[model samples]
Target: MKLTRLITFACLLFWLTPVAGQSLKSGAANNDEIIYHIFQRSFYDSNGDYHGDLNGIRQKLDYMQQLGVTSILLTPLYESAFYHNYFAADFEKIDPKYGTMADYLKLIREIHRRGMKFYMDMETQYVTEDSRWWKKAFGNTQSPYSDYILWDDKENKKPSTIVFNLTGLRGYDGVTRKITTANLNSEASKAYNLKLFSYWIDPNADGKFDDGVDGFRLDHMMDDLDNKGRLPHLFQTFWNPLLAKLRTINPKIKIVAEQANWFSLGNEYLQNAGVDGVFGLRLCFAIRSFDKKLLLANADSTLAMLPPGKQQVVFIENHDVPRFSYGVKGDLTKLKVGAAFNLLMGGIPAIYYGQELGMTGTSANFGATDANEIPDRQAFEWYKSDTGKGMALWYKQTGPWKDQFNDDKPNDGISLEEERNDPNSLWNYYRQMIAIRKANPAFVSGSYKTVNNDQEHVFSFIRKSAGQTILVAINLWDKEAEVVINAGGNAVNIIGDVRPVLKEGKLVVRLPPFGVGAWELK
Candidate 1:
């Protein structure tokens, strides 16, 4: 069935909310809120074709709704040369392979009906060889799109200004790369790239751009082009104006950039571009490496680096990188703890698809060094009976389970379906942490203070806002340890997982092996 039709029917199953309220609240933060990542192709179809269609996602509105995900980030849904949808073939089309234009509209309607927002990933560089823009530019050297794409000039008289294709390819290879001299600047190339960008934002069918997209995620801004080291400035020239026009369509529109390579550069780039938020690389790296100290420290540092009122978007993983479980290599406990921290942290938290379950992959597979990674890019697991009452049914229902070929041996003891119903499961813990964060104002947009703990294996901190305080303590160690909480006052145990007692005006708490606990001030 068509995705729109499925969404319209699904709309009947839930109570709808207004679109205005779906915008981010100006105050601190809300814990129940979440951004769920979905690769455009991973959504389902009734035909059993195996490729995820828009309608497939529409059919599963209940799954996302139940999880309280406030926003859905669709990874690069635009038409691309590859299934991954990075190399843009046509920005206008909605990738017929995913679904029809109507299907996308239905998705927007269904999502808004549930009071949730949707974000589409936009890859800024490299359109396909056969793209209309490219063909038009090539055919008419003086056409409007002539300056929209890149091409190498074959004839160069001056030896000093001449350049060589480092990747051993032809001119303007956006895929491989090139190195140009300092004196050599291509006004024509810049104009061409900007023109193509303008086409994406051209909504009214006229040459002049009017209405375009809700927002954009600037791709590959960190890399230097032409060795100028002015990529951000170049982006601002093209993107800043485009952002202004997009905001005119919806004042609340958000623009996030993928400034991955480094945290400092990403932060600086976002600030310079006046973006709403930046992808949090620090949190992602920590979760992927299972280095608890580094994770907590990086989170702290990222928070410190941001200017007041500007926020960061936290995620366990994204499309460009490997999945957290696969990246972390089956450390379910660390994954759970990292997730809890992400939820409790002050920034907006994003969850990539298939992260809730413990997914695993090796460097040989996902790192681009080996050919095996292609097969490892398996789809999510959706439906299969829980083996031994272990929650296989829930896993199958929640996942695009057929994505993985080896159905017989799945990740050991990792299934969102099982955890959703089980109160003590990791899923339950996440839900509870979100609930606690939501109920308390301190956890939202509060000030963070690191409490001095003697044990290096333990990480502790407090969130204080509007005179309320919530302390979070994690036993990064494998064995039990004593947590000393010196709040200088009496605080109530909110989660009740860990019991504490007052001693000499300080709160002493006993932590279990690899345990975590939270407290609330009375």
Candidate 2:
């Protein structure tokens, strides 16, 4: 039974209903968006093929919208030999394991029809041996595609390695495959990537972005590719020019870059590379540390680095990093605290899929293979028993790789089925926090300022805009504490468990262990 477009639309209509009296209002600006980042391969399985596909995502639209995210960001969907889809074999073709091109178009259309944005991840700096460039050019000096890939020898037999000078990577299927760096210096390669990016932005070429992705997540974006100095000044030579042409196609297209140097604030990328956003990697580490001073310093520095119209994509976890729940050791209160900071800290919040459900995973030291990331990118647990329809456990029976898998615990209150119905669950806490963020404009597009507090254990900040002011405070300690913030006025508790009162020209609130509070100053 093929899932027809009509049937899919019917399902969309059914799930699009507002859940639990919460509905996302349409026509919100991009700056006000909450992005839900998904590693689609482990999200949901719709065809019972054990692999998550475009159709699987279509079936879960209601779940995403109900969670209050305004946009969706997916990892690369191009055909690749690797499970994570970074080493592209073909830039133009959709991975056959995921679905057909029709499935992708339908998914994009439905996503736009619901007033949500979609972002595609692209890593065109490298390619696998299976790519057409490598096949036609390797060892063929006379081949026209010779310049398309960087070669270490005149015969073109030895292709340049990516990142750590590694020529090969082990895929999730336990097969080791060789990879080569794409020659970004070649004019042909740059032109090809420009065309590839333009194709996804408007597949039909009619200038209507209804069936195309709203933007792209430039993976591992760096001026000096791999930091080897081989591809220096790529921002001027490759990216800036390519991106300039893309905006001509869609003026509103957004591009976010994953800066290679995580320690740097990425101000250069925003100021020069023409990117709209960059991951706040420093801020993420601070939030995970549960230290008030670290969080305050990083948060201030991160926001200060952004250009006028650019944004800092704040998050606690992504496909490459360990889960926040794992870092907090599965403490529910700490998970809620993480959620509050992720939503109310006055930046573009991106919630990794399953983060709200308290999913736990950590990167393993599995030699030089890409399988080390498998644990962090496990299947999304939909059922409490870890067995049911739409469970995309593709790596379940795959030998040693599955041995490293520690996520998706069955009947452990970590699955969506277990958390969705419990009001006190981390999932519900995320939902409520998102609702609060959407209701307050200050938390969305306002200026972030650190609020001085008497206690060192409480991290306090204020998000201010015209006619709106929101003060957010989080208790970083494991014991209940009372803190006095340096702001006092008529205010009301808008979110969290505690109410703050004014005394001695200060706002005083009692916070429980790992507690959070948001108050709207009048």
Instruction: Return the top candidate by TM-score.
Output: 2
TM-score of every candidate: 0.76, 0.93
Cα lDDT tens digits for candidate 2, 1-522:
000111222242223221233222211123778999999999999999888999999999999999999899999999988888888899899999899999999999999999999999999988889998999998898888888898888999999988778788777677877888999999989889889999999999999899998989998899999888888999999999999999999999999999876666777898889888899877887888887766765777676445577788999999878789998999999999999888888678999999989899876766656777777888998999998898888877675767657677788988988989998999999999988888888887778877899998999988877778888888898999899999988778887658788999999999888888888898
Give the Cα-based TM-score of candidate 1 against the true structure: 0.76
For model 2, the superposed segments whose C-alpha errors exceed 4 Å read: 1-30
lDDT of 2 at 219: 89
lDDT per residue, candidate 1, 1-522, as tens digits?
Answer: 000011221232121211121222232433334788776464444345556778778777787766656778777777764555655667668777677877777776677677776766766445555466555655466666544454444222211211112212121112321212221124554444445444434444463322333445665443354233433354456555656655554566677776634334255655576677777765556544444566555655555455545667777665555556664455656666767667766677787666665544422221211122222334555533323321122112322322333432554455554556667666666667666777778876676666766676777777778768888777765788887766546667776566677778777888876677888866
| Model 2 global lDDT (CA atoms, 0 to 1) | 0.84
